[model samples]
Target: MSMTPIVLDARTLKALAHPLRVQVVGTLRRFGPSTATQLAERLGVSSAAVSYHVRQLAAAGLVVDVPERGNARERWWKAAHDVTVADTRTLDEDDPDALDAYLRSIATAITLRIQQVLGARSAMPPEWRSVTDLSDFRARLTPAQTEELTERLHAVAEEYVRQHPESEAGPDAEMVSFDLQVLPDLDVGDRS
Candidate 1:
């Protein structure tokens, strides 16, 4: 079955603005249902801290308690959806601050993830390193064309991910991360 991507609103975005909350949501998506203690061990944080962030994520509708996975004393949390879609165009025009917060939070999370991967790159095996890549491409297109390109690229990624779910990763299968960003080159017109 195909999972629908959650469309984030200003309120949900604000709730996910915290770094830990963002990490918690990512962890749930990557690792499946887990308790705060398990998440703490994976994140190298305290259980209380993980629990706090989990609550925030739950409140934001990004996560849900997996009651069947844990006893009453221990709560398990899972990501509400497999994918999260954020379109700045959907943001409320009257609330620019919320949009700014959401963008900053997303930027910080992506930057941190990239840094973490780079830090561990040297420790990875040769086979793993061979498949890793970091590249940039420039494109000149109108806003409509850019949106279409983004949708096409997203469809490709989504199809690949659906075929190979993250939860199915095994000993030999490593978690791969992909970041795709397409933006206009404002400097192109300005020689300065």
Candidate 2:
């Protein structure tokens, strides 16, 4: 699979500005491919509306058509990236309005995510009190090594995901959240 992050253009970002669209994308990212009917059910929206938004996402290249197991009527969609991001701070000099809108959309989506995760109930096993700790570490790395770092992180995430695939869960199980972000350790950089 290509590891390249999907660079969101202003129009594409605008397409994702709607809360429904963001939730649709998040659902696809978390659950793999899904049909509009399935997405509508999960998101508590009408299927027609979900279909319209899915088309918008497809037009923006934020989602792609996938092969279906059975009928031609089933439309499946998946997020273009494990994550979607602005990818750069350098705004297009020609379109500040679009850039501003895009930034707002990004911030709104992030804020929504934070709220969702914080409000969500944890699925701590009965022995939860005995089990977890949190911390952070700073590290230095070369630019070329960034891809390697991302892959290693994905591998670790996959290990945990494998142990608890969504299909294995009960209907009322609390969703476990995973957030991973990696950026250059700019503080240690040598400005030559």
lDDT of each: 0.82, 0.72
Model 2, span 1-192: residue lDDT tens: 324366677677678767788888888987888989999998789999999999998998888888654366787778787666564444456456676666565557666776654454275454442333334566666666876887798899878767776668886555666655666666766755
Q: Look at candidate 1 and give me any clashing residue pairs.
A: none
Q: Report the number of clashing residue pairs per model.
A: 0, 0
lDDT of 1 by residue, 3-54 (tens): 7589888778787777777778888888889999999998889999998888
Give the root-mean-square deviation of each candidate in angstroms: 2.8, 7.0
TM-score of 1: 0.82
Stretches of candidate 1 off by over 4 Å are 92-94, 165-173, 189-192
- lDDT for 38 in candidate 2 is 93
Tell how far residue 56 is off in model 1, in angstroms: 2.0
Q: Model 1: which ten-residue window has the lowest total lDDT?
A: 87-96
What residue pairs are clashing in model 2? Answer: none
